[model samples]
Target chain A: MRVFQILTTVSYGDAVSNDCLALFELLKTSGYETYVYAENIGKQAERMGVKPYARLQKLRDDDIILYHLSTGTELNERIKALNGRKFIIYHNTTPPDVFVPYSGKLARLCSCGLDETRSLKGTFEGGFCDSDFNRQQLISYGYECPLKVRPILIPFEDYKKDPDAETLEQMGGDTKENDHKIKNVLFVGRIAPNKCQEDLISLLYAYRKMYSDPIRLILAGNPSGLEKYMAKLKVFAGELGLEDIVFTGQISFAKILAYYRSADAFVSMSEHEGFCVPLVEAMFFDVPILAYSSTAVPETLGGSGIIFDSKDPSHAARCLHEILNNKELRDLIISEQKERLKFFGYGNVSEIFMKQFKEFTGQ
Target chain B: MSTAREMLSDILLSSGAANVDVPVSFDDISVCGASSADGYLESLEREFSDRAKVIPQYRDLKEKLGGALFGFYINHSVEQQNEINARFLDVLREFKANNDEIVRLSNRLKELESRMDDNGGIR
Candidate 1:
């Protein structure tokens, strides 16, 4: 099958780009021809010997256009013009708050949620969410889209394992000599207000106050035009005398993987997400997670990681204490997470996506 | 051409205006300047007759041509807006092309003008 994967950009850190690249690799391996169209192909693709086109001209009758949402303009008109089947993969939540303004007041009054109103705006042939919870939320908001039309819970593939000894040594830490005393917590995502970096700083402060021992907190992500926010967070950390925090600005994916491997726990206090890929990546690395209970976090975590009501820092600190103190519980959760990691493997997700595409095209 | 008293009374009645004594005459309206009493009456009668003849046709034309013209203007505006946006893009493209050509043309024009000045002022 010929598939055209449309994305906004070909950046390594973007979730959509990473997922599209993984899918492209998987489809090629499985004997399917995949073409990628993006606005700007980044250096990573050039290094990997992959060329992405920017225009939509080479599509054929045998080809199917797979568009990621919010990437292109006149999407519905273009899809209608296409000779073959067209499908939209909604990576973001439906009835997006962003659309509420364009819909006008009558739509707001008539609709239950933003998703329902957006579906009424006549944008897509079919839509999909990453989880059943998101699907149900759409339905409750008056979306008439079918359950089969919803997105499959495609998990991320686990990267090759690195031994803790190798990772610790690379980071200049001797885990054996120190008796594994390092409690390294890693947060790998864009540093923005929506990612709740401020709240994460607050939780770190509470954690410091509650625990006498110093723990290493590594914030490994781009500031993403939130330099002032990052500055404020650093100043706050300084004022609180929390000197163990490290802000590694925009490292490569390999470095991120290394941090995931060496870290004792993964922490994210994001306010919202369509899906948290790093949480699954953390699971693959077998690092115990502590995340805020919001949006897709709890659904993605699913009893694998520690969930805290991030509104209360005391509660988060308490959860952290429990995870730090109880090795047996932590080990059990990590084992369960490893077992569940199979579901999000690239092969499984690729098959699921292909099956959905086939069904959408009635092939 | 009706008397001012009669015109005001008609306007008041048409507009549902209230609170005035009835039975005023053309003599009372002479103070407000009409050509004459008979001329005022004749003018009002001619006006009423002309209106009776024109109102139906005016209503029909408004219903048909007014609506059609309004729709045409709305569609025209939309098309014009799109054309404006396209023209803006075209201007940007044109500005980017052949910067040296524009400079060369200006220099040539300046040279021609200098030659013309040296000639009998109208070569």
Candidate 2:
């Protein structure tokens, strides 16, 4: 039987797109006719080979199709009409209210996506959720079918593989003048309202106010669609007199590695997230993570990282200082994270994926 | 138009007249001036916070229209349109009442000024 994975958009460095591509590769190696489809294809995905989703009409009954449900899409109606066994891989949508002021169009799409997700009650045979948090959301939306929790299929080897040497060299050269006393705090995610970069600025402001030495905050993310929000964040930073903060909008994977390697602490103050992958990546690099306990962040951490309740600037600043200043606490946090990282290892996650997938598809 | 009390106070102070000690009431100031108009609306908003609460519905609609996403930018449904129109009409009525008050105050001040001028100012 054939297998097909469909998404709204497939872009490089995107978690959902990378997961779909990895799944496609896995299914292909297991001797199944697998196809990748999306509405908008990025250059990387186009180079990797993907087809338009309109070709879904050619699939037979015994085949299985996986729909990656994240946002509103025109393909929702078509996916519901599929003759083949279908499953929705639910990657929770951000709440519409979060995007209201920043982008009404985004807010509307989120609203429509929730409506679409709720409407697909019995259309699919079962559901696969990336986190238990998302699974609970599915249940809230009235999805009562068989469901399993699985991590995004990731090729961790790619992360471990030697980063682009030239990029690392460039980044390393730039850091040479540092007295090494300046703490390099990092947060890697898209620059958007829901990601709460403003909160990060507040935390930085408070941190600088209390600390003696200068602290560097490195925000590595693509801000292509959020120009106004980014500008607002820059203005806020300027207002706070923050000269050490860097917004590395859309950088290379090699640069990502260098940032991870150089970071003293991985701090995330995002109010919304769905299985944050950067938290795990930080753990992989042995970077101690201090994240706000919200949404799937605490669950994804698996009792590993430091989970704080308040995002109030002073409280967040103290929390950050405590994590960085105490060497023992930092080591203990990293040690626990390293153990938790094994839970998301390829062998464990894939076994979970393949087993549940086989039982659902009767392969 | 300045209130009679405001004009009297200005005239007495500028002309270095003796302390008249007139009773200064809220009506001594005109609410039609640019700065006073803003103060008038703020007082209205505070007094009738529920009316102020209705402002978000229109603001939200404007946001939806301004920040409309490409695919989700369908025309508003009849119910939505009705709700928007109702909120808009409510705002219009509120502003219309304020405008009427301003006009009435201006006309009253003008008539009072003509009477005072004919009588050669206050006795």
Candidate 3:
């Protein structure tokens, strides 16, 4: 009659997995008997007490289960049949159509995942979503359960740890001085079409041709199964003669942190996002954010960071130039973002989540 | 100055005025984008052609000082570079085909061996 968390796969540093682990930690340290099970657990997460779902031999009828629902469709389809007091944490799936030009396999999975989300209607006793956009999605999908929108839990302590020194020197140079002429603009997320990485490269092109030559665009994310998309972007970058654009494919958590630390401004041209957790991450690192206003992006920023309504690379480039070179503007954006970031602090978010979790599960 | 929007508008307006006199060329860009193989080279060629118009003026002077280096390298290597790249691509394709055949044959052998083991057990 304890608590159990389940997901199809749990990899370290993944936003959904991080949220699951955060809730698991909060539950455990607060004296609730909680365990997590995943079908395919990464080495780091498996080492951190996440069990193989195959090893989950028995579950009491009264046990509470929190399922992390993301893009993976296998567990999304199976969670309903598992014997437990069920609830789903909905991390919205990317639109399948966005991946059609890149990977058929991923597109099919996302198409099926959304269908499964609809099929999961009325099955759960309760539900939760990371953002209001996802909340509205669940509503449209007919999830008439007791639902709540709690901000994703971030482990700020992990971000505070020493970033990879090798990555630091490779990116920002050996010395941490403002004397370096290059301004590094960064975008961190999955290198998928919905993220609009091609626009990032175009922005860098505009920035270089129009404003300054000594600038860099670091696109740090996992492109594990999206080789075609990555190749196309690389070709595009080459076509533009943009040599300073980097597509960092599948980096370590510390290496990613180092990129954030090295970034002068965080810019996103994404067309779709569930919550865009990296926006908050940029805030965490004090990097001023200049993002295109899209679904859930404005909601996530909550009037904190600079949200522009244009997708013209020229506009983004000019704003990026001003943000990078103008110290007064950059400081104002960061200070505003810092204040907004407190809303997503682990202490604040975890408290709301834990309070709701216990109340819903009758713990 | 006060807000990002205001600051961006300021830059946009100022830059807009500045760019009014400069007409950005898209002719060479279209031809370059027709195929990735020729994109970079074609763009460079257009730039070189523009600069070559000045080459006639300093022909005797700069060519005497090893300034024919660019023409010498291009005339010597452009055709050869294309040939080499095509050859390299063909070799890579052949290498991939050979690897695929090897994997297929190995898998077939394993299947046959497994069938033989099954027959022996039955006998």
List chain B TM-scores, each candidate: 0.23, 0.34, 0.37
A best-first ranking of the candidates according to their lDDT comes to 3, 2, 1
Whole-model lDDT per candidate: 0.58, 0.75, 0.78
In terms of TM-score, how similar is model 2 to the real structure? 0.73
For model 1, the local distance difference test gives 0.58
Worst 10 residues of 1 chain A by lDDT: A98-107
- Report the C-alpha displacement of residue A333, candidate 3, in angstroms: 0.2
TM-score of each: 0.63, 0.73, 0.78
Candidate number of the best TM-score = 3
Task: Kindly provide the TM-score obtained by chain B of candidate 1 when compared with the true chain B.
Answer: 0.23
Model 1 TM-score is 0.63
Q: For candidate 2, what is the interface RMSD? A: 26.1
Tens-digit lDDT track of model 1 for A184-274: 7778887655576656666677776666665677888886334444555665555566656778887765667677767777888888676
Candidate 1: residue A61 Cα off by (Å):
5.0
- lDDT digits (tens) for residues B50-91 of candidate 1: 433421211233335764767566556556665665665455
> Per-residue lDDT for A1-363 in model 3, tens only?
688998888888888889888888988988888999998899999899999886775788999988888875667766767788999898999999988865677899999889988998878998888888999999999888889989888888888888898988787742235444677888999888789888888777776778644888899988765655666677677777775688788898889888988888899999998888899999998889999999899999988777788777767777777788777777888878898999999899989998888779877
lDDT of 3 by residue, B1-123 (tens): 365555555665765411111122222233223333323333333433443333221123333355365666644555555555556555655765686698799999788777675546522
